[model samples]
Target: MSKGLKTLLAGAALLLVWGALAAYTAQMSLPSLGGGIAYDPLFVPQLLIGAGIVLAIILMVQGIRPLLAGIRIADEEPQKTGRILFVIVAVGLYFAAMPVLGFPLSSAVFLLVFAFALGYRKPVGLVATAILGPLVIWYVFTAGLEAPLPAWPSF
Candidate 1:
């Protein structure tokens, strides 16, 4: 299959999954805080799902345009299946390690290792990103969003 067709298929699948998730989240009952503290537990989830839906639609549009124009969008190069598997395993390990190592630490390690895997050889940029990326995300969650994140190892 052409890359555009694959993209369209993936987007369609994502749209279906996101639609299902939106439906499920919509069924979540809001807890009554009663003090006029207007809080919706599903707000963030709904926002994210909405964004995902938009992105899926955009992907579908982009993918279909070339096909409609009678253009064969060829893959730039053959994809490396082994690299894809490696990334999948790495992501699984990152998730498994998060509770033990904490989000910031686990994320930093994952970013560092993944950057190396992708042939990012600049020492300063690698170090900076490994250190700063998780820190920024942690701050955004913990401070900006008023959400708590695990910053230290559980053990």
Candidate 2:
């Protein structure tokens, strides 16, 4: 019920999901172009996801420590409501728009909006993040590894 417990549970769930995904990928025979692929998708996601699961488990354990110390951020922070609201809205919009606008567009918009909202008030920083995040992400999936991103919607 508490935030720390909730965070622990969420991290546990993420670890489980990542573990399953990594196991599934392991069971599938990869093609002959064997090498690292966090940029490539060959063994990349599996590797990164597997590591993520481990890290999440670590986080889950660490999150429980504050409960041992009897400190709760959830009960005290007035800004918590606003933070949660913004995150929920942003995530909802991203998923909703992804199928409509495609990943690059949706992701770019999401980062730009979030950065701007987070008080990255300088126009240059805001513009640079808006452009750079998507460009870098696009290049990673498409050019670095030859992965395919979804096209703009209306297909």
Q: Considering every candidate listed, which one attains the maximal TM-score?
A: 1
Query: How do all models score by TM-score?
Result: 0.51, 0.48
Model 2 misplacement above 4 A: 1-79
lDDT per residue as tens, model 2, 1-155: 56887788888888888888877887887565545454344556666876898899997987798788897767344456787899889889888888789877788788889878766789887878777888788889988999988756645
| Per-residue C-alpha lDDT of model 1 across residues 2-116, encoded as one tens digit per residue | 8788888889999999999989887878785565534656667889999999999999998898788888878788789999999999999999999889999999999999989
Worst 10 residues of 2 by lDDT: 33-42
Model 2 sits at a Cα RMSD from the real structure of 10.5
**Model 1 reaches what TM-score against the true structure?**
0.51
TM accuracy, model 2: 0.48
